[model samples]
Target: MKRIIISGCNGKMGKKISSCIRERNDCTVVAGIDKNPESFDGFPVFAAPAECPVQADVLIDFSHPSALASLLAYCVDKKLPAVIATTGLSNEQIEQIKECSKQVPLFFSFNMSLGVNLLAQLAKKAAAVLGDQFDIEIIEKHHNQKIDAPSGTALMLADAVSSVLKEEPQYVYDRHAVRKKRSKNEIGIHAVRGGTIVGEHEILFAGHDEMLTLSHTAMSKEIFATGSINAAIFLCGKSAGLYDMGDIV
Candidate 1:
């Protein structure tokens, strides 16, 4: 059995993961940490990482970005393996995560949907083969409550496309203020936020006389929660290093 500590226990995703883990006989949630004191399946909730009573084998974090630095510091101090599902981390924070990877296993990704990861790979391949023949664009939609525009997953897709193209694609978020012509080398990204959308992303490749599109839509949040648990299972007994979905999938 794998012992687990769930951070951000009060959030929607955290609670879902807690419930999912509790149903399993092969794994157990030993503790939950969150800013708000609340009950999760009759488990004690700690206000901070320092207050947890038992040492956990792994720490799974889906908390806010503001809390990531502190949580990572705690993980490194304890040398606890972690699976981070939180988004909105800056470039510098990402570098910090990479550094901490040397101390403990760390897994991070923009989206936990296995399909999305596959989509990223496909986009990269299409970009590489198509070369400069096609214009790529990424569009993503999520719940209005989500604070970040052009969700992290979209950027990951853009990065994949850019990396394979051998040229940087200018990311154009919005072009409403002034009239402008579409540049041949730009990869446009449009974000739509509205009414309880679980998550949706589409990647479009437009070429002369032809259009090809690849898309992934998350039907429910359970997919992400379930995927996270799967990642946790894969991380057990793994060596210390930075890892991603590709490592497990």
Candidate 2:
């Protein structure tokens, strides 16, 4: 069995991942790290990674971005492969993750849902086929407790479309701030937060008289949790490198 350590063991995604692990017989959670570190589950939870005595084959992090530095250090020091599912990381932190991947296996993804990543692929193909004539807009919805605006998956979808366009599309987060007509080469991304909505992303491609929309809705957190668990399993024996959902799917 693959022994795993969970970072942010007290968070929503963390707990969901724990549940996913329990449902499987091929892996076990040896320890968990969280700021609150209360033992809600049978596994031992420590306030910090350094304090955890359990040895693990891989690490799965679903924590806040603020905890990234310490988690990375722990993983690197222990030579543990990591599956990072946290969103809203800054550019510098992302660069740090890339740098650390050189020393240990790292799996990172904007959205852990397989369907969402597939949506990104479809969006890219639609953008390539539609060309510059169509206007692109992305709308994303999440729970109010989500700290980041314009969920990372929104940006991922935008990147997918921008990668194939003739002119690199400009990301427009807000149109109200600018008093001007929408540019032909701009991709608009809007965010909605309310209630306990799991997640929703819609990509709209609007042409002169018609609109084509591609959307994905996440009804539960289990999709991401299951994906992360799979990622951890996939990373177990891999060489040092940066990996994503594309590698798994």
Candidate 3:
């Protein structure tokens, strides 16, 4: 059985993952670390990883980016593998993650949904086939409570498309502010936030008289929770390295 420790145990995604684990028999949450470390779901909750006494085979983090430093320290000190699902991290923090991965197995992804990553793969293919004939635009929607604009998944999709293109395309987040014609080598990304949208991303390829759109809609948070759990299982017994959903999926 995989003994897991959940970071951000009090958050929405944490609770969701905990619930999903309860339904499975192969793994269990040995402990949890959260700022508001109230024992809500039978597992012992600590305010920080240093305070936790229980040992775990792996750690799954869905907390804020600010918590990354302490969490990385704990993981490195304990020689624990980690699956990081937190989004909107800075370049420096990402570099830190890469550095820490040298000491421990680290799995990180902007979006945990398998469908989203598959969408990225499909977008890459479309961009390669269509070449410069089609204009590309990405539209992403999430809940209002989301603090980050142009969800990380949106950028992931954009990056996938950009990677396959002959010439790297510029990412244009807003066109309304700039009263100019769209550039041929630009990828437009738009964001929509309202209600309780789980997550939605649409990639549009527009040509002279036709448009091809690839989209993925997450109806609930279970997709991410389940994906994270799967990632934890995949990371177990793996060597120290930086991993992502592509490694598993």
lDDT winner: 3
Q: Which digits, one per residue and each the tens of the lDDT, describe model 2 over residues 62-122? A: 9989989998998899999999998999989999999999999999999999999999989
Judge candidate 2 at residue 228 and give its lDDT: 93
Between candidates 1 and 2, the one scoring higher on lDDT is: 2
Per residue, candidate 3 scores C-alpha lDDT tens digits across 99-196 of: 99999999999999999989988998999999589999999999999999989999999999999999999999979888999989999999999999
lDDT against the true structure, per candidate, is 0.87, 0.93, 0.95
lDDT of 1 at 104: 90
Q: Each model's number of backbone clashes?
A: 0, 0, 0
- Superposition TM-score, candidate 3 onto the true structure: 0.98
The C-alpha TM-scores of every prediction are: 0.96, 0.98, 0.98
Per-residue C-alpha lDDT of model 1 across residues 1-249, encoded as one tens digit per residue: 988888998899999898889788878888888999687477788888877766878888988888888888888888889999988888888898899999999988888878889989998888898859888889999998999988999999999899987677788988785388888778999999999999999999999999889999998888888888888888878899998988765
Worst 10 residues of 2 by lDDT: 47-56
Better of 2 and 3 by TM-score: 3
Could you tell me the lDDT of residue 34 within candidate 2?
Answer: 95
Model 3: colliding residue pairs: none
